[model samples]
Every structure is written in C-alpha cells, then in structure tokens.
Target: MDTSKVSSLEELKDLDMDFINDIGWAKVMWDSLQACLKKSFLNWVDTVLTMSQNEDDVKEWRSTFMEQFEDRCYELVTDIRELHEQVLVNIEKYLNKTQVLCKMLQADMPVIGQHKLGLYQEQFQLKRQMRELEQMVEARTSEVNQLRSKQLELCKNLGREPILIKDHPLPSLNEISDLKKHIEQLEQETFDRLEKFTTVKGELIEIINLLGYTPSTQFELAVITGEESDFKITEENMESLDLFLYNMKKELNNVKEEIYQLRTKIEQLWNMLDVDFVEREEFRKKYVGDSLNTLEALRLELKRCESLKRANIKVFVDRLRQELVEIWKLCHCSESVRYEFRFFDSDTYTEDLLELHEVQLKKWKIYAEENKDIIALLNKHHTLWDKMIELEQNATGADRYNNRGGKLLKEEKERNLLSKQIPKIEANLLDLAERYQLRYGVPFLTFGNTIESYINNLHANRENAKKLKLSARKLQKEATAINPSTSHMTSKRILTDCPSTDPKKYKYTPRKVFTEPKKNPKQLQVPKILLTTLSKSKRLSVERKKRLDKIRRLSRQKETRDSSTYIEFQNDLSNRVDLRSTINVAVDNETVVKENFKSPARQRGTTPKSVGKKSPNLPNKLTAVKSQIKLIF
Candidate 1:
C-alpha cells in the first residue's frame, strides 16, 4: 500500500491491519523492526557498528545495555505503581460521586433500554461511566466558569465585590451551585440597582426639564438617555443623583420665586407707566401659569418694562409724582407732605429713586383705599370749612361795600349755608376720626396735628371769646353807667355778630371814635350817611305838604343840573381851567385811610341800615379826578 495515497488515518490503519496476517508482510515488518532496534541501540555499542557482522561488539554492548535496561525498568515500574495507586484513588472518588449523581437522577431518567447495554463487562461499564462523568464535569466546569464570569460582571456593575470558588481540576456540584446562587444574587442586585437608577434618573430628568435646564455632564446625559447598566450603581452615585434632583427642584423653586417677584415688579411698573387696563389684563392673562416657560415670559415682560422705564425715567417719574398727587388728594394729604419723601424732590432719574417714588405712591394708594370712608368725610369737612372761612373773611373785606346786583345778599345766603353745612360735616369728620383712631390705634391727622386736638383747640378758643365778650360788656356798662340789666343783653347782641377768637391767631385793638363835624345852623346841607345807624328816627306818614316840599327841592336841583354840564366840557366852554381837582386830590390824600387809623372793633360796634352803603361825596370826588385824568391824557 502506498502511504501517500491514503486520505485518512482510518484508511491507513485498516490497510496496515489487513497485512498483519501475511508472511511476506511479516518478513518485511520483521526486517524493519530489526533495523529500527539496531538503529536504536547501535549508538550505545562500543563503536556504533556499521553492520550486523560485528557480533562480538554487539554482544559486549548488549550485555551492558541489558543490565542498565533492567535497572531503569525496575525504577519505572516502581514510579508507575505509585502513580497508579494515586490514579485509582482519584478515579474511585470521582466514580463514587458520579454514581451518587446517577442514583439521584434515577428517579427522572432510566437505563432500562437494551439488555446488551446492561450485559456489558464490569470494567467496561466503569470505564464508560468514568468517561461520561468526565464529559459531564467538563460541561459543568464550562457552566461554572460562565457563572463566575457573569458574577464578576454583575459585581462590577453593582460596584461591589465579586464571588469566586477554587476548582483546580474539575468543579464540584456544591461549589458550582453556590457560585450560581452568588451570581443570581448579584443579578438581582443589579436589577434592583437598575430600577433605582431608572427611578432617580426619571426624577432628575423631570426636575431638570421643569426648571428649563439641560444636562451638562456625561452622567447627567447618561441618565437622560436612559443608559442604566453602563453606570456603576452605588450609594454614593444614587446620593449624587438624588442631590442633583434636589438641586434641580431647588432651581425650579428659585425660578418660581423670581417669577413671582418679577410679576410684582411688573405690576408696579404698570401703575407708574399707566399702562392701559386692557394691556395689563391681557398680559396678566397671558402669563398666568407657574411653569418655567411662564416664568421666562414673565421675566421677559419685566425686562421690557424695565427698559421702558429706563428709556423714559423722567416721564415715568413725573407720572408717578402726578399719581402721588392724586393719591394725596384722595388721602387728604397736605401739599407739603410730599416733601417728606426724598424721591418726590429728587432730580436723579435712577431706578432706585423711581422705585422709591413707586413704593410711596403704592403706600398712599393702599392707605386711601383703606380709609375711603374717612377720607371722604374729611374732604367734605375741609371743603365746607374752607368755604365758611372764605365767607367769614368776605364779611369784613373792603369790597363789602361794593355789593351790586345783590352780591352781598348772595354772599350772606352762601355764608348761612356754609354755617349750616360746616358743623354737620365737622361732626361727621370728628366721628369718623374717632372711629379711625379706635380701629387703627392711631389718631387722624390734619396739618400734622391730631383731629381731636385741633377740634379741642377750636372749642377752647370759642369759649374764651364768649367769656371775653361778657367781660368787655361789663367793663363798657360800668364805664358808661348804662342800664345794668339791658347792658348785658346789648353786649350779648353785639357779641353775637363778632367772630370767635382762636388761640392759634389772637389780636385786639380799640375802636376808633367818629365825631360828626359841626354843621351851620342856618345853611342847608346835604345829609351825610351815618357811619352807624346812630338812632331810630320817628316814623310818620308822608303828607301833601311834605310831598310839595320834596318836589320844590327836586325842581331846584333839576334847574341846577340843566345849567351845569360835565366839568371838563364846562371848563372848555368857559375857557377857564378849575383847580378844584388838585385841591380834592390833596384833601383825599390827607384823609385817614381805614386800614391805618381804624380797627376791626370800630366796624363791630356799628349797626348800619344797609351793609354796603357808600359815602355820597366820595363818588362825585372820584368822578372829578377821573375827568381831570381824561383832560391830562
């Protein structure tokens, strides 16, 4: 057979075994074996024989080699015996363990198949059993190794220690099961960690989104991307995630707070800018939610308002000041009261100062609203009181005598109305102020003084005026020796028209005496208007004789008026200038002016028929001066 022609080991072996029974093949094989033996031992021969003819040398080497071979063979047999014993021990132990597993498996699987299989020789059965056990061990070992690898991976992922068992030759059942249990536990832990990571990651992501932020780090990105296993799950890592979530929530809260404050700022700006209600309401409706986008929108709105405010700081400040003025008016605040605020006078158009003014205006507005009822009453009282004072002042005014078209009569009517309205309003004001003080634990103020205190001052001054008037009457009656019983009545009547004295403004001066100029007994003169109604004249019905006398006097006056024209025209016709205008002007200049020589008490003692009657000669003198002025012009 040609070895090169064989395609496989099985074919080669079959051919070699087929020639085993052939003598010719046996002769060739014997020759080859003899040559292979000679080749193997010839080198130990004395000279390494070149041919089989060297029998004597072969014999000498053969004797020495036989002895050495026997000695080496004995040593090899002894080592082999010991190795065989150790091998038997390992085999028996592995075999017993396998047999036990077989017995345990007997309940599930059975060997009740072919009779020939059971009829196998004892040694062959044991050998097959050992071989099968080896194969099973190999499979088990591979499985345990896989479990160990899985355990390591899981432990690493879980950020914990790995579990392992030593198996030198073959892994045992118990160790393999224990390792699987450890792997299972690690797997469970990994699952739990994954769950926790997923939960925390979701929370972190949700909070971050709510706060309108993005992931900035790889860990955060991993959480957001839902990569749970690649990351090591540990207490510290979870805590870090929790902390990250907490920080996001905190950021969201801060954003919400900022939004609230921004809305507040926008409201104040709206008031200062007088933003239309429609726009304000629309903006409020637009940015009503509490989401991050809402907060952002509100921030933008606030920024816009702030920009507008900065762009028109002066205009805004002026507008705010004007609002303050209106609010002050509502609150019944005094004009000088605005001086108490620095921003009210500040020229610096800064946001800080503007905010100050806004704050003040807001405060006053709240105050006005809170004290609405009281403010209304106070304003009403103030109006009536002012009118009353005005009418009273007009009582003694120099123009009091210029009443044309029933002007003085109208004033008296209004004065009487104010007198009626003022006390009622004042009473309401006082009641309201008392209630205010009771409710708020602070006094109602006017001109910086409490209402109660100011009212008391007025009352006290009125009482003092009454007492002073009574005293003045007693003194006058004692000096004049007037009827004592009637004097009190007359003084009380005089005092009824007198103004009450307030302690805040007190003054006193004596009345001036007016003595009539002595007139010629025989010369008829035009009757002078009495400074006061000196006495009542006797009344008598007009008779025919009196009527005729009055008509004769009127005719004489008519004749005189027909002869004399205007002073300047008469002078032109006569070609003679009169010097009387200059003399009259000098006389008027030398006369005592009421303000200089008279006092308020002088007018109080007089009871005139008409309140505003003028002197007769005074107008004629004024006309002469006017005519003189016309000639000069």
Candidate 2:
C-alpha cells in the first residue's frame, strides 16, 4: 500500500509502536483521521444516494455509522481531561514556587532595605548639617561685613583709610586672628597708658589743689602742649611726661615749703601779739585806736625786732584801754576819769610809761576793792531787772491773751513784787553811789542812767497800756452800738436792759396762750364799695370772697400792729392776693385787704395755731415784710 493512503487496520498494525504509543501524536492523528472520515462520509452520502435504490436502508446505514463514530470519538476524551487537570496542578505548583522564591529573595535582601533607610537618614542628616553649615557661613559672612563696616567707621573717625595685608572684600581667618591680636595689644597698651596718665594726673591735680591753683588748664598744658601737633603715648613721651611731672612736683614742694615758712612767720607774729591768727586779723580790721603802728602795720613790719616791739606796744595799749574801760564800767567813774584817759597816748609816754602803768594799776586795785560789794549788789540788781523785764515781756506777749485769770493774777503779783524789789534795789544802789562818791571823791558804778531809762520805759509802758485799754473799751462800745443784737450777753448795757434782775428770769420758758383780741365791729364790716365790687367782680369766686372776708375778720381782731404773727399773716395775704384786682376793688380804702383763697379745711380755722405749729408759708411772708420794713427804714 501507499504510505500516505494507508487507512486499513493492517497498515495501522505495521506502523511503529513508538509512534502509536505517543499519546500527543496519536491524539493529533486521531483528530485528523476523524475530520477526514467525516469529510469522506459526507462526500460518499451523495454518491450512495445516487446509486442506492432504497432510501430507508441508506438512512438506517447513516444512523448506524454516526452511532459507532460517536462511540469511538470518546477514546481520547479522558486523557484530554486528565491532561487539563495536570496543567492546572503544574500552574499551581509553579505559582507557589514563584511566591516562595519571592519570599526568600525578600528575606535575603533585608540589608538592602536597611541600607536604603540608613542612606535616607544619612541624607536627612547631611541636609540638616548642610543647612547648619550654610547658616554658619551666612553668619560669618555677616560678621565679616560688620567688621568691615566697623573698620570703615574707625577709618572715617580717624580721618584715614584702613591698612590691610590684602585688598579682599572679606578678611581671611588668619587676617581676622591677626587683627584681633593687634586690637587686644592696642587695648592693653592704651589701658596701660591711660592708667599711668590717670595716676600721674591725679597726683598732679592733688598737688595743684594743695597749692591752691586752678588745675584744669594746668593739667591740660602738662599733658599736651599747644605747640605739639600729634600727641602719642610712647616710651619717650611718657619719660618726658614723667620728667615734667617730676619738675611740677618739685615746684609744688618748693611752694609748700614757702607756704610753711610764711605760716611759721604768721605764727611768730601772732605769738608776738599774744593773739591767735583769727584775733590778729580781726584786730587789724576792727581796731578803733588812733595809732600809727596798728595791728596791721605791726604785722607788715617784717623786721622781727621792730615788729615785736610795735606789737608789744599795741598789745600793751590795748590792755591798758581795756582796763580803763573796765574800771570805768565797774566804778561808773566821774567824767574826769574818762576824760583823763580818753586821749592818753602811749607813744608820748616813753619815759613815764612805767609810772603811768603803776598809777593806773594802783587806781584799778583801789577801785576794785572799794566797789566789790557795790558790784555784787549791782549784779544782783541787774539779774532781778532782767527777770522783771522778762516777766513784763511775757505779760505783754501773745501768750498773755490765752492766759487764764489765775495766771494773770499771778503775773500781776509778780509785777508788784518786782516793783517793790526794784525800788528797794534802786534805793540801795543810790545809797551806795552816794557813799562811794562821799568817801572816794568819785562816783561809784551807779546805774543811775539805766535805772532812770528803765523807770521812764515803765511809765511809758503803763501809759500805753492804759491808752490801749481805753481804746479797746471804746472799740467794744462802738461795736456794741453797731450791732445791739450781737452785743455780749454779759455786757452791762445788755444786762441793764433785761427786765428781771434775777438771773433765773433770763432762763427760757414755755410760751403762754396768745388770744386774739375781740374784733371791732366797724373794722370787720367790709366797705360798701369793696363788698359791692367783690360781689360784682367775675374774677372773685365764692370761696375767694369768703377767704377775703375771713382775712379781714382776722385783721380786724388783731389788737397790736407790732404783733409779729399778725404782720406775717398780713404779708402772706399780700403775697398770695392778686394785687391788680385787689387794688381795683379797694382803691379808695387805705388798707387793702388782699387774701389768698385756701382749701375749705384750712379756711375753717377761726384761730391761729401755736407758734411751733405755725404755717411754713409764714416765714416767706415775714421775709417780704422785713425787706419792706428795711426799705422803709
């Protein structure tokens, strides 16, 4: 048979078993054979129909072939189903293996993730550090700029340009370090120089102050001369300054020595005069003696011998004059004694000076012996006089006004005692003066002038006090006349006018009842014209007419025109009444009865209330009346 067309079972049996046993290849051959068989059967159907005489046998033959084919077509169906299940299982195993591989890879590569995280962290840290470095660089740049500005400012202030190693915009770190070191050195140098300068200047100033000189200009000159253009603190300059300071100190020492010498001279001169510096100066200024060689002249007489002699003479004369004045004061010597010594010139008494001194000393001794008791008496009298004057001053001082009667009485007693004592002392002083005058042929220390002056002052004071008292009484009387109501309650004028002599009568008492007087029938009757006018006037209501009639009745019943209550009621009526209508109604009448119509309840009162319960309206009316009375007055 032909190999390509072999379709029989003998040809299939001759095929290779290996080829037949291959399921994939066998299945592909079976599918191809089935498709070919179907195609051949379809093709043979037409031919068979054309050739067959029985159609039913052909149909039955086709149905039997389809059933056999159907039975044979399921031969590879189980293997195909098994192959599909195996393919699914392989796919599941492959997926699981891939997942496990992925897990293993993930587990093995943990270091990569950790490295990535560390890299990220390092990146962030680097960024932060970079930011910090950038900030530091910016700060450094700003600082450098500021330093440049400061340098420029310093250069401007110095009126110069900055000197630098290089002309760069920013200084290098080395340059900055060098500049800082230089600045520190300059500061230390400046501080040292300033400290030395201050120390030297302080010493110079103290020396100048001690020398009593103004230091500002001198110190300036010492530190800097006007001729020098540039002043710098160098070793040479400082040495020169030290030399100048030394010279100044030497000059100050010389001046101090001279001053000390001058002070010594002054002390010697003061010793010569037996006076202190202050006393000598005071004597020079205020000495009242007629001497060519005054204290000042003696002080100026530089020759020690002449000055000493002159100063001795001046001191001697002063002592003599003081003794004379004392003796005169103590003994109250006659005018002759004062006249004899008044112009006693010490210069003209060269030869008789000792004799004069002896005579004056003897006279002083004798006068002192004689006046010792009198002096004691005078001192006592003077003390008592001073006390009396003090008491008198106290009596007349502002405090006197506040003094109570007891104090005043005590003061008066003291004054009387002083008066008695003063006279006795005066008599004793006069007796002593007479005895001294009679015995010594010279007046004693008689306070006659002082006593006379005091007596005169006392008299004058007494007269003044009497006049003041009289004037005060007159003023009081005038004031009383001016305002009788305000006069003192205890004043004689006020007390004299009091009705009762008994003091109890002045005490306050409750008021008694004040009855209204019976009305005059003639006064109570309203004039025919007023009654007719009131009845006719449309303005007058019945109540007002009745009120007017009531007021008229009250007025008629009043007995006294001076009654304050009646006057007040009248004033109230006048104020409340319509004046124009009232005048029209009673134009002819001398007394116009103007009345205010009140409520029926108020109008019902026929009698006035007690003064305590009187109407408040009464005061206003009374004020009006009083004002009118004042105007009349």
The top-ranked prediction according to TM-score is 1
TM-score of each: 0.34, 0.24
Model 1 TM-score is: 0.34
In model 1, the runs with Cα more than 4 Å from the true position are: 1-151, 163-192, 208-218, 227-240, 281-296, 318-343, 355-633
User: Candidate 2's residue-wise lDDT over 1-633, tens digit each?
Assistant: 233222322232245547656588777887899899989888878777787869787877777666555545443454665766765565455445434433422222112223444433534444444455445445656766666665554444334445553323345567667766655555566567767866776776666555444535553575643333244556666776687678778867665555455545555455646656676667457633322233334435435534464536655555666667777677656566666764455565342563465478568768678678877777777787667656644543322322243454566567668757865665665556556556766544343343223333433443343334334435544654466444333333433554432223433222221112124674322222122222211222344435434543543343123123324434544454322211111210111111122223336854333223433322232332221210000
The C-alpha stretches of model 2 lying farther than 4 A from their native spots are: 1-311, 333-337, 344-358, 403-417, 440-633
Against the unseen true structure, what C-alpha lDDT does each candidate score? 0.57, 0.48
lDDT of 1 by residue, 335-445 (tens): 678777756888988988778887898898888889888677766766665565455444433233232455555766786576567556655665676667668877667
Clashing pairs in 2: none
- RMSD, every candidate, angstroms: 28.9, 38.2
The candidate scoring highest on lDDT is 1
